[model samples]
Target: MKFNEWTIKDHYPEMALQDIQPISLRAYSLLNRNISALGPNEGAINLLGALEMLEALDYHFINFTQIEKGESPINQKHEAVAYLNRLGQLYFFTKSRFTKKYIPDSESHMPKVIEFISIRHKNTAHRSLDSPQKEPDEYRDRQAFTFLGATTRKFLGNEQYVFPNYNKDTNETEWFYFTPAIDHPIIMEQSYNLIEKIIKELLNNL
Candidate 1:
């Protein structure tokens, strides 16, 4: 669906009345119509950024859904990255706009949300070297290798070899790697729920 067609009331019927409705309408108006009264201020800029990121989240989520339905792993992987990037941006934007009271230290969703953000950060945004000490346990000891030209053999896809190191002191494996995994549809559903919560809270604050 187009971004303009993504109405707040459709997803959140409870926000259709009272203070929330007006704020929601105004934000959309500023975004869609470029209203002058809402412009030329930090609040307007942040609100616009949040709304744009919200649109981006929906855009990537729909693309991921469509690609998954097509049953293509390669394309699905690319779309998943796109979706995660947008999700991270929205999460950070929400955090920036609200106080700790709104997002809180003990929020249940924070860990998963941070995982999603970290995936984008380490893999796509910055492209880390998979350091054992700095990277998470699952992302450590990774080496990307591709078999593009082999005279005697052929490989279907590139491989990332992971060397897990045993730490005697901890009595556990210290290094390992797994392809960054995310259940796109489930996470997207959670993201939509999160966006709704953020919008409600933001409007109430406004």
Candidate 2:
């Protein structure tokens, strides 16, 4: 495939709110940079950057609204599930009220994506003082992630929104999927859309 390109709008999508969180800002930044730096030497580094980028995006984002209210969870899995729950809540409340489907469920990743991210966070994102698992193969080679149906979702008439096509016979959304380099966009898109959704809610409702 050819290198990805971005338009002016892609680079600057309706200037972010004054009080936007760092997680959202960071994700947009990574996506912009990675998309721009698609080349031989740079692409690999950008991919790794994208990997670490999503760790922060998901880790910090899962805490977005809940953190200030003291509703944050200690475990990554809990935080992730909470994030998905909030998304579903928002969709239910807003979708019927608004004429437009402004926030596509496609933007959000299946919650089980947290399992892949949590490990990456430990290995690279956090880089613990205790012990972090660092192996050459993890980065040098493509990695695979498989998630069960519990964390997956497939909305009818929404096939156009799905990213990273899945095999119909052995779909993770149905049962499980194993694929590499799948975490960044999933985490980034949900965080990106969530931030926009929050801002819109404030502007339209408040």
Candidate 3:
């Protein structure tokens, strides 16, 4: 789907109008629209940097995953998984924009593309290679490797996992990453504004 038509609600059903007060929901929707409009080409805001910058903007941005969803599997584990999966998908989509805009002639740049893909695969493999330990915690860490995005990792108390995509060729996992629900309206607004600013700044440099 195009960025302009995407909504937080599609991914985060927990935050329905009935779930959150109307005013908050409105604010959230507005914010989501704003962020959705920031295509990578328009401002060149790459996914990894954008996500990290958003997290640093404020405490709310960092803790967005922890917000109460009033649903099953609502613990930190679920929240972490949900946020990570959604964020990864977000990165993937944003990366596509970047690729289309910057690497328009992929056929001409096949070698370069292959090199890039190799680097990306290496990075991801480095992060998720088979573990040496068989303990439950190690297993949880591995699951985190598979499920969480770089932005969501810090929130889940794992700060060492870096954004490893160098070639953007890996597609071993798929998860729907998005906002938790309609209750956290502030996030929608914050994300939208932040995305706009980031895109604008990135475009200026490009």
Candidate 4:
């Protein structure tokens, strides 16, 4: 929630070997700035609220791993990754809506979240491997999947995760969902405040 102090560490736990991706960080900064600047516009405010909620869900993933424990190192990492996967679902919703409004015709409007994860894993694994004969362990892949599952849950509910079409409208829909392994809290109060701010600014400018 505190945008200024936020870091990738606050979301991705299993990826402890490195820092947050520059692209993601930039994305967050831009989203935050946009939200603040356009806070007075009703439509824009709603979008900003969604964005913040999504960001918080992600930030929670990073915070979850900060908990120290006496459990096996493998177990700790596995749990962290599980949460990461659950939290990732938020990106799906945000991507879907944003694309529908901004780039409706683009087939790839939805963010390639899994692809991003795969790239992250591949890069990290390759960097850690010593030689051509060495390959990243399969267990590491499992761990990354664990985090991914967590992200999905945080954003989508069980029904949505189990069957995305269950509550969805038929036809060309801009919204898509991932698995429901995570739980994202909807901060209506903060959302409303943001909305009010945007409305005020827009009215003042007009």
Q: Per-residue lDDT for 1-206 in model 3, tens only?
A: 23343334423345653343333333344345445444333432353344443343232333544455663322444443334444343334334556445334422322322323322333332343443222244333544454344334332433222333322245332232223343123443444444444445444544
lDDT of 1 by residue, 1-206 (tens): 22333323233334432233223333453343322322232344545566666566556655645653447455545555566677677667646734234555423554456545544555444333433344444433231111111111212342221223434467564433222223443444444444445444544554
Check candidate 1 and list the clashing pairs: none
lDDT string, candidate 4, 1-206, tens digits: 32223322333434431243422333334444344444434354334455454455445444554545654444433444443353344334334554344434322322344433332233223332332223335433433443333323333323222111111233221223433123222222222333334334444654
Collision pairs in model 2: 172-176
The all-Cα superposition gives candidate 3 an RMSD in Å to the true structure of: 13.3
**Cα deviation of 184 in candidate 4 (Å)?**
18
**Candidates 1 and 3 compared by TM-score, better number:** 1
Each model's lDDT comes to 0.44, 0.35, 0.38, 0.36
Cα deviation of 199, candidate 1, in Å: 4.7
TM-score (all chains, Cα) for each model? 0.47, 0.25, 0.27, 0.32
Q: Worst ten-residue run, lDDT, model 3? A: 159-168
Cα RMSD of all models vs. native, in order, equals: 9.6, 19.5, 13.3, 16.5
Off by over 4 Å in 3: 1-74, 98-191, 194-206
Strongest candidate by TM-score? 1
Better of 3 and 4 by lDDT: 3
Candidate 2 local lDDT, 161-197, one digit each (tens): 1112222355322222322224334544554554345
On the 0 to 100 scale, the lDDT of residue 183 in model 4 is 25
